[model samples]
Target: MEQKREISDEQRFCEMRATVEDCNRFACALFQQLSAQNSGNLFFSPASISTALAMTLAGARGETAQEMHNALQLTQEGAQLHAAFQRLLSETRTGGVELDVANQLWGKTGYHFLAPFLETIRDCYDGGLQLVDFQEEPAAAADQINEWVSRATHGKITELVSPMSFHELTRLILVNAIYFKGAWEDEFEPERTRDQTFYLAGDQQTSVPMMHQTGSFGYFENETLQVLELPYRKRNYVPQFVENEDGSVGLMHTEVPGGGGDFSMCILLPRERDGLNDLEKEIDSATLQTWLTMRHQEVIVSLPRFQLELEYELNTPLESLGMERAFQPSSADFYGMTDNPEGLYIDAVLHKTFVDINERGTEAAAVTGVVWAAGCAQEPEPPKVFCADHPFLFLIRDRQTGWIYFMGRFNQPEHQAD
Candidate 1:
């Protein structure tokens, strides 16, 4: 008889730690760029963006590949990188969390993509190649792509690529969609939620529905801010199920914290009313890693019910991160994709994210579309009143793998910027 092995929590954490570093680095650069542009309500999935680009990178060659590797901080190559991502993605699909990651490649009809390029993505990312006629009918192609994104993301992300985005210039478009909807382990009382004033920067204030809960949660804080971990429900008992990629034993854990809660929300609230900007400056890959190890404490958590939707053009920020070659039509070299690299370059990279947090649990979805145009959270403490009335950062992370899925800031209950 042959024996099957399970990935230890420690191993998954380490791999996710490495992945977080790369994802956070890119995220920091992007946030800084958006801040410079005076953008608001920051929300997107670096993991989704990275995953789409990683699938594209499988076809990148020469300087394009090297530059991308450097920019994304992906030092591993060939077998090592693929295997690691495969295992990590598998390990993250815990039983209690509803997470679905899908990939697809849409190329201009009559375009001959190399066998190795297709094989690598299929093997590593489970990306299926789909043929679409962009050169002849761009609008129809855009509709098809958008329809897929809509279905994959459960309609949260409808328009990933606009009709005008597609034309005779397009060659290959790689897409990645991740949908996650998890309910909190400790359910919040709906009746406890009431309208509260949310403090924005300076004198701005908005009325929002705030949900209050008191429980023993994993908490941490510093002089400048505080963090609270709201864990999601896990499987309670085992049933008829097969091996899951995320190691979530179905119904194995009825509640959270005991059987296993692979998903959680970490809220970073600034100590000061208007310290969100300063707080963002202090957070990087290293700082994030440090916060994960913060000890948990019992406290009261007061959180606001909110929904956030965001879309961004990521060419500038990713280019600034040292991935300039891949975006340049002339200099870009994706030879591994096809024999000739003529007029084949990243046209644009687009990302869309939606998050809804209520009294029950959280529902979030993210979609990253690489049209070849391309591109590329916190804590608290107190007996913790955790009154997040002001601007604060938050993220949906996998505790088992340390992978961050949805990252956002709550600056307003309505359409307002952070």
Candidate 2:
């Protein structure tokens, strides 16, 4: 029986791992769709979006649930899926960084929802249901929900929900907010930052402030792309190796604690300055996972200091990913959320994100609302060069779980002339 219990625990972990894999695919699909629409800068938080949708999924049933499951490529079903979410959310702990993930459900004050739905959210997602007057005071309800999101994100995302999006039929709104701030393990000296020429698409160029650093980082490269992992500061130290007198390297297990982290910002720079489009075109889950593998080695990194804030309405993009019925009120089926025969359909999905990457590190916040609707690299013999002087792809993710929190592309650089 003990062996069986261990096996059961392992299987549950596998299920959770599968969920992360599915989220990787979902991120790729979303980036492909959104990138195609916008030729400039693009950024979004897949974790935030997935978490909010997962909350809604707790109350979804029938085809609605299956569509979401398929679109997300979720492996676990029913209770297993929620349990996976619970563990995943709990496992995102790191000591030296400020990482916060918050979820909440705002339901109509008078609307009657199934107890199981609310309980599942509270238990698995740590999201408690908050009653609001969406029926009579839609604007107030939006403000209340927005305030929660803003607080969760440390004001990085203040107005995620617009009052105009609320309607009489909008009975529930699910929200997920994530905020992360981590300094680079080896921070760039502000004095080293200088104006550099960043090549943009269409043979354009812009002067931007680029930070420079020379340190051992996770690095990888191929004939087509160069990948660099800039880790954030975390609690405790990571294993490092030093060359011995006998020309051998040995692991230094004991070091100053709190010198490394489990979170990193991975930048994928194309071999050719203008190869971003082709690189992006070839992105898929398998190829992406391949690119993320890296070895720790000495690297010369040059990264631009940029800030971006963007909003997206994900209805069409999600529909394109085979989640069609959820947006269609007539065809949508969310019977598990409430006893009402006229079930809830995903009315709108609004997402807002803010990221500031400078010499210090990265401070990012993303808030995703389902509106209920219900709705790095390796090492080497010699130091490698990873200069983001042109269009490139970037991902902020957990080094341990391979879960992408935020992903984006930097195409046109904002002028930061010193």
Candidate 3:
């Protein structure tokens, strides 16, 4: 038996960095597509979605593999991407924030999946494969998956998989759930909150409770828009040196004492009352990279307290992004996953997300289930006003890694409690 070679720290860091970069680029592309399809509020976690699909990518082969690699903006090799995810996920756990990410694979009882495929997900994603009675009890299988997701997300997400989505023919289902709750480093006072008129598209307006605050924040602005960074309180973590089995010391990176692991909500506020559409049209990965280069300064800010829940059938959107063959039952190729003559193809890609931002901070949860029934910043200058009085784009991200946990457009504010 050949012993597995241990990966060096430098190699691990490179892979993790590549994965983060790829996911960020993919997030921008997907956001653009979603914005084009939906006119109202749009919210989804590109991290959660990409993680789930990357697990599925472990089983993809031929055109299916190539298309997924293209759509995902993967820069690393197939097997290396999984290892990078493992490193990235490990880093997330060390961040001193209330964040939890869970991944699991549900397989029909007696169904045969390549052992290497299951092992890869288990080792990299911590996504253990569980045998379920999808053949005899599809509903029960879905409930089990949902129950696990709910637990992983601390009840923030309950139903990730619908029984209607899978049937007796279902062979596999891959799921990823992420829950994040962070308090603002500088919180908005409830006393300062007041109802404000938020201008909507087509010269419409609605009253919503807007949180106001004046403090030193990361801020930047140009002729077109304003960028604000509201940081989250970080938990302190100490690094430990652990002796490896071979008696060699390895650096533990569970939490960086004060590195990029700090979480922050970055808001891109349009200068004009209704310039979100224009901003969306002009923004991409490179554009976003430039906008995040902000400086710190004292600024006044007014942001609407909002909550949004959205669910989407991602099959069409993903197909439109160039992974069309994976959805085609006859043409799909997942030979890497299973040797069964009737190859598995993606049946449906379900995504659900919930986000609430208020005076305190932000609490967000997202779940992505890839049913393999077939297969699937910165700132500060002067007191630049960042009044998100109209439509804007917001995302919660890891500063060091540039990993976007949740990204969306906040259009009309909904009536909700703070």
Candidate 4:
């Protein structure tokens, strides 16, 4: 008899990491498509935006691969050929820009193949991304996608799509879908949340709800930055913090020191809202990676908490940013896979996200064994005042794979849901 092979814990962990990585890559491609279409309206860095796209792709249906190829006029073999074509496209570009090739392929094919994925996402986002597929009439697909954008984002985002035309021989559809909903771990009491003065830049201030709290929580501080962890009403929802050297703050996914298990929420509440612009200009992939590897010393953090909800539609923005080749049936040459290749084309890509942050903590809570950091400092530091009043970018990412699950900016807070 053959000996039974046992799966080790590390092997299981690696498998999970792969699943998350695949999802992240797919979603990042979709995000690239969105960014390509909408040029200047977004706030996150390109890499952060890519991570958000990865998060969305995690929710896509497994059948999407087959459906997408069929719509594009490619067989499994043909799709593989198209992928090879993309590889060649990458080789043609110089420097890190080569990665843009992946984004281009996603932008082109993601939109066309996204119908079914959108349908699944609609149910996930509470009736967002509704597109009526009239088999007999076959109305303009762009129009349908636009309608979904209008309804899902509560009208904050309009015209996510435009009229499109393709050669009858090459038009193919690819679908990308995403679904995310997170609540605070500690619930903010509506009564406790009171309108307080929020300090904006340049001696500016706005009255906003400032949720107050004091508890034994995860905290860290250093000469360059201060850190804090605020759990939502749900244990699963924990937002981490990273205060910068200049007193400005930003949000980051909290990971275990030494690269252990999953990630936690970390939001860097910058001292100045406008400081984000300068901060963004200085940020690059390497900067972020360096920050994560830093050794933190004795730290304590206290933060005033609040709640927020946000949603976005990112298709139109992606196409306008130099990725039009993938969407064009004539220009798209995905014929390497099958002999019966009439040519493969792409249709559309769609994404939706929901998050609620409050004083009570996150809505989804998960209890797990905590890994203690050895020789770390104790004692909470005086809480730095950080409030998100103006426009700011946010992202959700997987700790292990550095995959971004969601990315968007909160431009108008009033439009957010409860």
- Each model's backbone clash number: 26, 9, 12, 88
Q: What is the lDDT of residue 371 in candidate 2?
A: 72
- Lowest-scoring 10 consecutive residues by lDDT in candidate 1? 373-382
Better of 1 and 3 by TM-score: 3
For all predictions, the C-alpha RMSD in Å is 6.8, 7.3, 6.8, 16.2
Give the local distance difference test score of model 4. 0.36
Q: Which structure among the candidates has the greatest lDDT?
A: 3
Off by over 4 Å in 2: 1-7, 237-259, 373-380, 416-418
Error of 3 at 118 (Å): 0.7
lDDT (10s digit) by residue, model 3, range 1-418: 1124479889878878889989999999899889989999999999999998898888888988999999988888666777788889987643556888889888878878898888888888888889998767878887899899889878877887766767756888888999998878777998999999999998899999999999877777899999999888765667789999999999886643342338899999989987898999987888998999887788889999989989988888898889888888888999888998878999888899988898888899999988877432344345767788899999999987889999999987778854
Residues 204-269, candidate 2, lDDT per residue (tens digit)? 888889899899888888999999998988656568888999999999865353656888999999
If candidate 1 were superposed on the true structure by all CA atoms, what would the RMSD be? 6.8
Off by over 4 Å in 3: 1-7, 236-261, 374-382
Q: Estimate each model's TM-score.
A: 0.87, 0.91, 0.91, 0.48
Error of 2 at 120 (Å): 0.8
User: Which of 1 and 4 is the better model by TM-score?
Assistant: 1
**Range of the 10 consecutive residues with the lowest summed lDDT in candidate 2:** 1-10
